[model samples]
Target: MTNTTPQAASAAESATAKPALIERNGIEIIAEAERTAKPRDLFWPWFAANVSVFGMSYGTWIFGFGVSFWQATLVALIGIPVSFALCGLIAIAGKRGSAPTMVLSRAAFGVHGQKVPGIVSWLTSIGWETFLAIMATLATATVFAKLGLPSGTGVLIAAAIAVAALIVVASVLGYHTIMKLQGVLTWITGAVTILYIILTIPHINMDAVMAIPAGSPQAVIGALVMVMTGFGLGWINIAADWSRYQKRSASDASIVAWNTFGGAVAPVLLVVFGLLLAGSDPALMDQISYDPIGALASILPIWVLIPFWLTAVLALVSGAVLGIYSSGLTLLSLGIKIPRPAAAAIDGVILTIGTIYVVFFAQSFIDPFQSFLITLGVPLASWAGVLIADVLTRRVDYDENALFDANGRYGAFDWISLGTLVVASVIGWGLVINQFADAASWNNWQGYLLEPLGLGGVDGPWAYSNIGVLVSLVFSFVVTLLLRRGKIRRQEAAPATDGDN
Candidate 1:
């Protein structure tokens, strides 16, 4: 007869019992038994979050760079996939480490040093979530106006509250709930988005679009940077968060493939279509500059506005949910002693406050806010470069225990990686220019090296070309690869903690 002690029986029961609807996992390594997620599972969240009609606004934004339809199309085609592929590469770390991205980053930056990037990651996530919430609220109010409802400040506030609440609830409920919700949202939003495209097809004037003049080479590069920063780099910090639940046995190539495919497919198609429409109509481009989703609604028939608005708002919420959820994990990795759900709620509250300020109080918020996020993207790309190098060099799986234990192999701080991040960011800032005329005066502090580098000063031909993001990424990556290979190999060979076995 098999004898099972009470302790064993209880443990077995706990393991076999259905997981709580609310996700309890935080920054810790996912338990092996629960790592049942497949590579294809990554498709839903990425696809749903990115399928928003707002991607079409990139068409207008790219054209604003003075690029022709063909040049803009080339930029979108190259930039979107390449950027998300970086995300895909980072996602490989998740399957290998079975922990949140920042947690796994401890391998490169050390336990204490990881906190530096962690703070940036947290702030970036919060900023992104808030931005999405603001967009959704505005989209809601605009749609209501189209529907002949009162779309005043009060309505905007109500919409903000509603959007914030929805994002918070889904994020707090956590991963499983989010995954299921994203799967459903993907179908709903995708179908509606397709309908939106079909309805707006007649608006595209191919001849006018073809007649648009081509921008300078520098302008093409600038448009490319915009597409990348707006799409992939925006989400790279949290790239691994969604994949942490993937089974350890999952193929890394598959992880990258699914992530890249899911994220790139929609944006590429949407942005190209948007380019056609915006290139054809200058007035529509102006409308999109101020209000992306609502402007798209302006082109559609009154009958389809409701569905279009609903899909756009839902898609925005889907993105905010992903951001808030990852931001919560990032919070915990920062040593915040709170449950994941509570952390998500905290970010949601912050998002709500930010939305209120932007919608109700701030004047000319979007341009500055966007420019600020893009500026921050320099450091983020630097961090990503360091982490990607570390991931590529280390052959063994992350020492899961060492990731949390400062005294272990990963150490308390990695000076090489941290130093690389700082240097790269400094150089990067000097290379990029803040093109937003309404941006804060401080933003002009960048591009200081422009004249020295002979790239023309801030007002030169390369002024719009944000080459700093790429420079930071490449510089940090190469430096880390050259310097950290030995350290990573030694760290990997170190003795595993008793629990790790």
Candidate 2:
């Protein structure tokens, strides 16, 4: 006879219970039973998302700042890993709170005040996902053209629709599904990427690369800022989303280490390789500025083009999937009354629309978009600085109940944090200049204080030196550390329900 005892029946039920294919959790604290992820699992998503050949395009961007091969190499080495380490620091908040990053900011900014940065985070996520989708679609069209297939307007539209659909489907399936997908993609994409590097090695001219002259100090700093903003700071807003599932018992150091390792390893190598390729051929560098992934495929052997295109597109989609997933949670944290799947679907639709516009309608979008991102980076750096300070100052776990309760220990608004964010952003903007000639008029508002500070006007020697981004980060971090410590300590010490898993 079958086992009928209570223990045997429970065992049978447990063995048969499978996790839902679509995750339903939103911004709420994750249930203890579901917090089963390990710190090492973080490596898969970070590595997969970052392993895209597009990173090679950053070499072109760095070179545009007038830096030489060795100078750019130094910038890439320092910028990539150091920037990602910040993401690792932010991930600590996830393990402590078991909530989304924006939601956890409530302890520092209060429930209502957190919305300001939350909106910025959401917009950044949507912009990045749409950008990736557009890249994938373009990659597909380029590869099809190289194969002698008809690559017309219709083909572009079709590719966009297809890429958008893949990204949407993966994102709507949510966290657990993404984790498994990312892990598998990491290996598939990593191996193909290696093969691509081997085939392209012959194209690299070390003699020409070494012959290029070094740029000015201002240009070197600009290159460093671009590298950081492009790689790590670009994704910091969503860093914690991947870690919310980590077991509370996971070591903090291990969490940071894995997060840093997964994110930094791929880009550091790719960018250095890119430096070699771009340095050898100025024409290739120019092409990369306009079409990163597609231009990358231009140099490949026709036989490898097919696999290169496939891996390239998949890598872009993998990164977009992570963005959309976190964007969905961010939407929820904004007080949207919808299920997680629906939020992801909503962001996916927006992404599709944005991709269509960028791919089909927008004129001279690339340079302007690059300038826009750099401009936005200042405020984002300010936000990161404040949040990092809050994360480091707290001694106790985030109070789960208080995170949602404005009337509780957190209150309705923390004016000090709000003021710091605003002041830092304003000053940071003044210190920066938009070097892109094609940038929109509004972007011209920057560099107002550049003349006053004797850095020369927007067209001066320091024109492209975007030291403002660094200033914003340091200014906000120090201010918060000095002024907000007591408030953060009080919040930590206040009475609340136990949030420990």
Candidate 3:
């Protein structure tokens, strides 16, 4: 009805063609007003994104490790919120700098110092992508076997590759698409989980749940630490990766609240579910040690189980996509010259092979998954401390262009951040390894450190509730503050921010 000029028509077409969020390629500074999202718009996407089997496996650890129901619940209560608290804070950090989370760390660590966190972030992303991909693939292969399809190593690897392909597609599409799918998945996963809860309810045993038989303090504490490690420290690294797209006007408190609630809800509920099922049948519980999927699958009917199976497949994609997407952004943080989609594709290929190897070739898949959690807890925890402290102290004022330019103000490296990581990592690892040696099984993952150091003993005070990570966090925080405060004073004394400053 109305005539439009050619210039106006072209502009309209360009606007329509653009993605709701995530610019072309993967990691670049997001310009303001580009795909701005609100706080509530932020919540469900994150919440549903986490409604996967990974949380189930993590929660299963609480019961598998012999923690009582109430004890497991307490740890879940404390640990999930604690981890998400860091996540929420970091999510707010997402707003301050329009770059990915790791990129923002450059401000605190300096240009050169940024590489340390970048490398760690990339490795974690790739590791998780491979791990979840393998787990989800194997779960799907099991379903394949049930459908009269021949199942074996070959079939398993094939299924894994299929899932890997999906991850690549989603990650290549980038942030907004992933979040949109997550919104749909929230309903899908919730429906399946609700059905699971219904069947599981009749079997709930009050005696088992309330039953607190004889247990030593050492074992109890160890269980709590492991539980916290499972749900909390494990996820703190990537919290801000999702929240960086929020509208600049989004309130920090609102972001923190929604992020915390969204992140905490599913894991806590699922862990309690695992605790209940532990009471119903102890034998099925043992299967968790070997096959977490099969063990849980054994609980539901074959018909109702389809939805659950689909959840695993979708969950794997959701989880892996998170890693792949972040890995792309992380590559950019490395100052790599590659485009975002290419970076993500490269990550996807490596993970595809890794997933196949871990599924078919590795002696076992679960141990590595378990070991990485505690092993990573130390360094990531330390980084979290330094990162959050820097953010709060500086009030999230960042100079973006300088972050990429080595010669720019942030400097090639900050000796303080690097030095803090080294010292904190050593201390934190020692505390964690000592705990491992204390609880050393036949194939102790930490045995390499314990035997050489001769630190063998029973559980120590630091072993309880991931105090090792806590110690690393507190130590890093204090050291960063003291170091940064002096640097600020020196900067005031001199106009230029020299290496000393």
The estimated TM-scores of all candidates read 0.96, 0.95, 0.87
Best by lDDT: 1
Tens digits of per-residue lDDT, candidate 1, 376-413, equal 98999999999988888878788777887888898999
Better of 2 and 3 by TM-score: 2
lDDT winner, 2 or 3: 2
TM-score (C-alpha, index-matched) for candidate 3 = 0.87
Residue-level lDDT of model 2, residues 1-501, one tens digit each, is: 011222333344545445689886788777666678999999999999999999999999999988889999999999999899999989999999888888888887888899998988898888889989989988888889988998889989998998989999998988889999999999999999999899999999999999989999999999999899988899999888988889889998998899999999999999999999999999999888778998999999999998899899999999999999999989988888888899999999999999899888887667877788888898889999999998988887887777777777887788988899999999889989877755566687888878888999788887788999998998989999999999888877888733321
True-structure RMSD for candidate 2: 4.9
The lDDT for every candidate, in the order shown, is 0.89, 0.88, 0.69
Instruction: Give stretches of model 2 more than 4 Å off.
Output: 1-17, 497-501
Stretches of candidate 1 above 4 Å error?
1-14, 498-501
Give candidate 2's total backbone clashes: 0
What are the RMSD figures for all models against the true structure? 3.7, 4.9, 6.0
Task: List ranges where model 3 is wrong by over 4 Å.
Answer: 1-17, 20-22, 146-149, 212-221, 434-466, 486-501
